[model samples]
Target: MATADGEAPRPEERQIEPLHLPTPEEIRGQDIWNNCAVRSVASGVMGGGLGFFMGMFLGALDNPIMQEEMTTKQQLIFQAKQMGRRSISSAKAFGIMGLIFSAAECVVEKTRAKHDTTNTVVAGCVTGGAISAKGGPKAACVGCAGFAAFSVAIEKFLDRHS
Candidate 1:
């Protein structure tokens, strides 16, 4: 359509809309997220199982003689402390393990796909620290898994919609 002057519309007067397209990098991002979801679930299960085993093993380490010789309150205190220690140790161990696992995954991604590994490592560390501080090893595992799943879901959703 032309204006009263019968001239084509100027470029400045025309609206320019930007088109969105998926780049190669975005495809890689989607793949990373898909992998992350699976890995997180696996890591959580393993960590939780290991923590349960460790807790059981630690609980069984009480000395029979020591138990028999202790006063009632002393025994109670000892038991409480032992339980507390187990939780603390389990959480710390799992957290550290989570970090290691993430690091390994990041390295693998870098080597195999030459993808951006930054997000994986950062997410792993955050998940590990959170689980360690709040839920112990079992909690850490669960948290990591959840975090991974959510992260992947969000990324995929954004990719598809955008």
Candidate 2:
């Protein structure tokens, strides 16, 4: 409608319709796959960084007596090399683990039944155990239990809030 000044009313002056967003269930397959890939990469980077720092801290703590015997410059150089080696190894392990775990979860969510807490827990346990199998049966079992517990806690938190 035109105002007294003979100019049309601004668009904001008109009524606006609300937008209907797609629900999670309604998301397309390609979009879901893309999301999963992106999430996996992000998880890998975060896990790698965490592992690197942890390795550095633990490495430093492991050899205090030896560190004290060395000259300051020598100790610093040795520790740097040690930390670098440990951090790189840890970063590789964590990055691979995160990538596998996230990808597995995404696959289970997309291919199996509808996404739910149960599916998430199962996926986490499976991936965790599989990844930890390199250590030993005991480690695998522990990893499975840990991941399951973590997933359950996260699910519960989300449920409570949402």
Candidate 3:
């Protein structure tokens, strides 16, 4: 209803019932799941696209003569197929890594009752190492180190900025 001043009553002044909100624990759990799904999908798509372009570029660089021999349309089609293959490989790697990291985070949350940077780094390292294990021991070590470093850097940057 409008007040005498021709303005509606303020929300606080009205007889409004209290709204029920989920508890912090419930919110945290939902947030974790939501973030996991979103981040995993996004990472997969982005990684795939990046890998595709990089592979195409490197392929072209490796055999400039072969690229030059093909017609424009033919080259485009060939590059597209190559890019697609590389993209699929990268997408799978990133997708698996994201799933593993998410699962590890959930486990940590359940056991420790809190999420922290160390847990995130550990999860990343494990995921990266597992993904790279197909390459060799050295590659696995490098992947683990790279992921751990990346996670720590990101966490520190976020903490500093936030």
Cα deviation of 141 in candidate 1 (Å)?
27
Off by over 4 Å in 3: 1-19, 23-65, 135-138, 160-162
RMSD of each: 14.8, 6.9, 6.3
> What's the candidate order when arranged by decreasing TM-score?
2, 3, 1
Which whole-number lDDT from 0 to 100 does residue 72 have in model 3?
84
Q: List the residue pairs that clash in candidate 3.
A: none
Q: lDDT at 81 for candidate 1?
A: 71
TM-scores of all predicted structures = 0.37, 0.65, 0.60
lDDT of 2 by residue, 67-93 (tens): 667898888777788788888888888
Of 1 and 2, the candidate ahead on lDDT is 2
Model 1 Cα displacement at 143 (Å)? 27
Superior by TM-score: candidate 1 or candidate 3: 3
Q: What lDDT is obtained when candidate 2 is compared to the true structure?
A: 0.79
lDDT of every predicted structure (CA atoms): 0.63, 0.79, 0.70
**Preferred candidate (lDDT higher): 2 or 3:** 2
